[model samples]
Target: MVDYSTQLIDGNGEFNVTGLDNFMKAVKLRELGLSYAVVAIMGPQSSGKSTLLNHLFHTRFREMDAFKGRSQTTKGIWIAKAVGVEPCTIVMDLEGTDGRERGEDDTTFEKQSALFALAVSDIVLINMWCHDIGREHAANKPLLKTVFQVLTLQVFVLTPLEHLEPVLREDIQKIWDTVSKPQAHKDTPLSEFFNARYNLYATIKQANWDASKVREKLRRDIEAHASSVRSAKLSEIVASFEKKLGQALAAPVESLLEASEKDTWSSIRRLLKRETDVGISEFSSALTGFELDQATFDKMVQNLRDYARSVVEKKCREEAGKVLIRMKDRFSTIFNHDTDSMPRVWTGAEDIRAITKDARSASLKLLSVMAATRLDEKPDKIENVLFSSLMDGTVALPSSQNRGIGDSADPLASSSWEEVPPENTLITPVQCKSLWRQFKAETEYTVTQAISAQEAHKRNNNWLPPPWAIMAMVVLGFNEFMLLLKNPLYLMALFVIYLLAKALWVQMDIAGEFHHGPLAGLLSLSSRFLPTVMNLLRKLAEEAQGNPAPEAPRPPQPLGSHNFKGQTQQPNTVSSSVPVSSVSSNISSTESGDEYSSPQLTHRRVSNVEQAESS
Candidate 1:
């Protein structure tokens, strides 16, 4: 009259297979098939095996009463449903070894029961008393040996009672050391055999009984719903996380930038570390709504961290770009502007070496601000980007020599006019310094061009006609007014002035006096006064007559204004007097309103008015 719900098999190797079916049915798990895990427990007689299973699984397996004596309580295998675990767990209780009534022949029953449990179970628990660890027939040893020899499909876990001496746990390690020998294969250990057996059992179980196909189905389910997993909602979550990270970083990054260049990156690294921890924790909590398993959730966390890092890095680069602009402006301010912040019109008097050296130092200091990234993970990359961007061209040079140096430094300057470096970051200090030297060279070359431009402008603004042309206009009587008489004296004076000017120009060219230096500038200035005085006299005579003064010539428009038809046309005339001062203004903000007009150009208007009064 055995209770089928409690006892799955009776003594004498009689397996109550129907008892197992009935118990599973009562628990509503028989039809569930492979949607559950099977656990079995075995140990020495009265080693609290039944009590342990009852407490652990919350099952009603009968335990032996100490007063009634130490007889076997579980006669065979007792199966029951686990109370608290997920997916319907079925726990199997095996008969204890060293039975008082049974003799040595009982080993046959123990081995058969263990084999049966191993065949059906995924995990088997081996329980033993602390005192029995080193005993000859330490019940667990023979049972474990039987399972190993038989190569049963189960993973065995040893359960050591806390009431036992701590030293007894050493016995478990000792036993494993003795039993974990190579099986039939040279390098194969006993654990490998057990693992292979367990995997085979699981495969068979899945094929015959498991309707859910748990592992395969989980994989396919994740795959089928991958788009949903990576949905626009998830993207929005990532973007939100990035926004939070950015907001967290903005204040600190700005504070770091306001400091000295050397301090900026170091401060940013510290700031990033502090903010990243808080950001990751918050982001992880938000991800829990997706209800993913540990593995999937951890993978998503890693991807989110990677994305956040990239976004932060991109922002850091943009900030670095702004810093680079500030740095270049600092260098240019020192090199191309005076203490008054006026644009430098490079006269030969300025010290080229001192200005360039200061600019170089400032540029280097600016570069040092971007020596590392916020993570300090990609210093080389950050430095390279900053350096490349600073020296990248904004304005093209005007001369052939300038173009030559630019071509050597940057091949793309002519096409895109942007000089970015190739893929790899600049690594060594030598490499960085070398690039800096090229940049310094370009700056110095630019300064030289500026000086040459100013010099050319000064020469053109005070330009005079050739000595022969002046003689023709003054002495040959090809003037705008009617000449009543030919004056031979005036002709002689003009001839003498022409010869002097021709000699002076030839001598100046031979000595390179017009090239530069204060003496050369003075000489060039003195030579142009004669033409200005002669033009004034001629204008005065014209206005004295009833004829109005000829309109002053206007500068030609720039090259792109109109198409050329290869014709010379007369200069346009107008009734209104368009003074050069009124046409263009060059007043500096720092200057007094009346102080900085374009006096050289304005002098033409004044000469016109004086001539009108004199006439």
Candidate 2:
């Protein structure tokens, strides 16, 4: 009983999209979809077009009052739903044609409105005065010509028996023949172009007698229109649903595939099922008005499920194509970053062999996950086979190595896996073996580089000589040590020389410099040794001449606190007042030359000298 009415177009030829939308919603016209029918009325000014529609379709379109005299009434196209009609008819009342308000020069709105009515309406009622039926200048003639040119459908003339002459029908036929036709339908007859012609009064009496026949015709026409529209829209709707599902599901599936957790495939299956179900539900709701058969509905739903699986398969294939890059990335992530996700320094303490094993295992797990589609929720031996055959190198030995011992065939020699289907497999066993080989080949340089760095770190931190070398020095230099101990001034001079040598060593970072190789270290030392020694001598001479000594250098900082470029801080110094006494005490207390001359012990000895000077 809802009365929904809206002006569809203004007099200025502008369409009222907002008003139309509101009217359509109010009338629930969209709910009908293609099942609805449209009926429109168009004729000359004051031809009672609106009055005829208001009576015929039970619409409340505004009609001009006879007492108010004839003029423009409906300014534009007005749309309203028919109160009671089969197949939900919508009616439009177009503005009157050839009005004095818009002079004869402007038949633009008339022609445009007529064309729109013919294009959209299933039934058009052209209301004209009975007196203007055979007149050459009848106002409805141009409207009929417009309809004939665009389309020729069934026509019903509503006139009295007196005006329904044979010549009147001849004039209508002449108008159709004279109207311009597309080349495709130029020679087509009017009867072939249109469905049927009926005199209104006679047909109404005939319809009253056999109403069921008339109803059947109307039903057939509605079904034909709805079927054509539904067929075209069905494909579009399914395609749109598929596009939406893919857009929503692709990224998350790719991410989960990359992660490859324990339940990754299960999680993906759940996700696909959830999304597909939602799509099917929404698609079903959208096609409810189409009244599709059960088989068609089930087929469409199955197609959606198939599309979802295809999307997963496509994503798996894409990830498989980039498996090598992902494997290398996984290796680098585990190898380069520590347990806390910090970059590894290869400080000689880390177990590179165990770390390489773990990293390869993780990469292998990624390969196993991507090697096949697991929608069946079944586990495979991809990981175990790959690890044992490729990583552990447990393949069959060559004939020479076998030496009459029986051995199993290589597991990775086959192009497929046991108990796995061809469609489900993305990467076969042989392909995985080849990929692992390439992965190891690509990552070998990183392992070698880590080993080199660890070796360098060990070399740079080794300042003291080996225990055997220390024992040799103690045995070979025992006589010299005794000679220096007998002469106190010789001992002091040796102590002073030792202090100078230690200072130069700290400043130059001799341990770090020698890490490259002994030859490189010696070459570097030879180049800079003399100039450095000359500079030290000049400074000592300056201090001896009573010039204030330079400030003492700060103690060496902890590892990672110092600059990485081998720049070392200068060593601590002893007070000049107790230099001889402190040197004698240090030499007496020292257990061995190697221990006493070490950088750590040197710092402690200087700290003791400073404390003694303070006390």
> What TM-score would every model get versus the actual structure?
0.32, 0.59
Q: After superposition, how far is residue 354 of candidate 2 from its true place, in Å?
A: 1.6
Q: Which stretches of candidate 1 lie over 4 Å from their true place?
A: 1-6, 30-35, 147-167, 183-615
- Per-residue alpha-carbon lDDT of model 1 for 1-615, expressed as tens digits? 223246778877676777666766677775665456677878787777777655555577888887787887888888877665565667889988878778766588888888888888766767665567567686467676667655445443333444343444444344455665556554654455554211111211212344234334423433333344357567898789878877877766755664536556666667777777788898888776555589977887787666656655665566555654555666777888888989887664677667776776677666555433435434333433434534443333334654544254432222211222332121223344454666666566767776776567656454578789888887766552334236666667778788656544542332244446658667654664454345445444654674535334333222222222122222332233445324442221111111122323332122344446768
Model 2, 203-263: lDDT tens per residue?
2331224444444554465566556657879989988999989987899899998888778
Error of 1 at 557 (Å): 85
- lDDT measured at residue 311 in model 2 versus the true structure, 0 to 100: 92
| Model 2: lDDT of residue 23 | 91
Summed backbone clashes in each candidate are: 0, 0
State model 2's lDDT. 0.75
